[model samples]
Target: MFQLGKTIVSEDILEKEFVCNLSACKGACCVDGDAGAPLTKEETKILEQIFPKVKPFLRPEGIAAIEAQGTWRVGTDQDLETPLIDEKDCAYVIFDGSTALCGIEQAYNQGVLDWKKPVSCHLYPIRVKDFTEFAAVNYDRWDICDDACSLGKELQVPVYQFVKEALIRRFGEDWFSELETVAAQYQKSPRRR
Candidate 1:
């Protein structure tokens, strides 16, 4: 791990490759997880505010879950997260044919809402753990995303490059710029493969 500003970033994000192959996975990351998408406290408020606009984009079961459980819930770990539908799928998840998708993001795409989905959702494969002084940023490897890894390998897209916008969103432009510098230097090392 290397320190960048207030974050301790794992080298795996630079070394490992991943690009979502939605056709292969059919958006399993949104539906197959035991828990709902992780959210910040502020995102919970945004969901509450935008529910009226986002509601129309969601599936019936998702609407029902959100109505019954609220837009967000405290997880077993006490972290804020989106609500779940029947403890199986995220309450904000909608389906296009067989593929699951985020209703919140759908709403964004439709220009119905200004906010995109939660930053955590936007930054998949990179989980951030916030501490008092800094955040720990690390690549999250999941068996379900095997196809994505394969695609990334084929495309030569590193995790950091693939999630460029998200990392910039989570951190700042300057931070990401510094990260790029580190990446360039790291790439020059004979140790890199």
Candidate 2:
């Protein structure tokens, strides 16, 4: 298991060997809270190209804010005062009885749209905490229950490879090296309770 601050997670849970029964949860992650996630420059450009309507919502300044403050708010009700979407919670969510799917995911899969998604969408459950030693990546179990959710079930080798590529495309090679160091440290650390 991995530990980040107060959160604990099992590595086995992250491996693709498991399958997430999100159908049972009815896409609870998407509908209940804000669709909070970070958008890289590439993602923002792609989003602007595809979803012009959402272009105004992409905050370049907010990215700097998140880098400085470690978090930022995305999406709000019509009043625009309350947070409606975040990294762990997405408000424009829909569950078709079983298998939680986001409209963005569906659109990308259907070829109706094309854009680089935010990092949060790419790295669900796992969050990256910037650090001088190494950026800490850990699972956000509190976002959902402890039930084993298989991220690998929906992922194929090509998709996984693409995600890795996207990471490089978004954060550059240096960030990946830093992530490797963090992963190595976690592997060497004592097991979490």
lDDT value, residue 2 of candidate 2: 51
Relative to the true structure, how large is the alpha-carbon lDDT of every model?
A: 0.93, 0.45
- Scored by Cα lDDT, where does model 2 land? 0.45
Q: 1-193, model 1: which lDDT tens digit per residue?
A: 9999999999999999999999999999998878888888888889999999999998899999999999899998899999998898998888899998889999999999889899998899999999999999999999999999999999999999999999898898999999999999999988986
RMSD of each: 0.7, 9.5
Among all windows of 10 consecutive residues in model 1, the one with the lowest summed lDDT is 33-42
- List residue ranges in candidate 1 displaced over 4 A: none
> Which residue pairs overlap in candidate 1's backbone?
none
lDDT of 2 by residue, 46-157 (tens): 5435544332232443333334433223344321111233434343233455555555556666666554345666665555555555455455554353343344444422
Provide the TM-score for each candidate, comma-separated: 0.98, 0.48
